[model samples]
Target: MLGWALTFAVLAIVAGFLGFMSLAGLAATVAKVLFVVFLVLLVASFVIRAVRGQSVL
Candidate 1:
């Protein structure tokens, strides 16, 4: 998921450089959403691990 977000971020940058405004905007939005989701899941996993008395790292 994090990888996908980075991929979309790069795609957005490239699209914007090529003057594809719509594609860039869409890709940027997707990247943002994916990044948020990734963060949420990461935190959740950490919490679950802590609750289980396991090392989150």
Candidate 2:
């Protein structure tokens, strides 16, 4: 998940550096979405793990 974010981020950077504004923008947007999804999923997973480890309420 994070890997994909990094990949798009790198692609965006490279594209921007090469002056491909449209591609860079698209890649950057993808990277942002991936990064956000990664964070949300990461945190949700931790919460789930913690809940599963706890005694029944």
Candidate 3:
């Protein structure tokens, strides 16, 4: 979910600040993947609703 992505992003920032390069990189990668997945799901939901003649908003 988007919340999970944000959580990982924050973790990445904190890890980077603490100089945990490996952890930061891993967290950042997870955040990016989650965010992309979230966006894809969101768009798919919108398209589905539109096709059903329902409000996307």
Give the number of the best model, judged by TM-score.
3
What is the per-residue lDDT of model 2 for residues 1-57, given as tens digits with 9 covering 90 to 100? Answer: 899999999999999999999999999999999999999988888888788896333
Candidate 2 residue spans exceeding 4 A from truth: 54-57
CA-lDDT, candidates in order: 1.00, 0.92, 0.99
How far in Å is the alpha carbon of 47 misplaced in model 2? Answer: 0.5
> What TM-score goes with each of the models?
0.98, 0.89, 0.99
Per-residue CA lDDT of candidate 1, range 1-57, in tens? 999999999999999999999999999999999999999999999999999999999
Q: Summarize candidate 3's per-residue lDDT along 1-57 as a digit string, tens digits.
A: 999999999999999999999999999999999999999999999999999999999
What is every candidate's alpha-carbon RMSD to the true fold?
0.3, 3.9, 0.3
- Each model's backbone clash number: 0, 0, 0
Instruction: Compute the lDDT of residue 45 as modeled in candidate 2.
Output: 80
- Model 2, residue 20: displacement in angstroms? 0.1
> What residue pairs are clashing in model 2?
none
Question: How are the candidates ranked when ordered by TM-score, highest leading?
Answer: 3, 1, 2
Candidate 2: global Cα-lDDT? 0.92
How far residue 49's Cα lies from its native spot in candidate 2, in Å, is 0.6
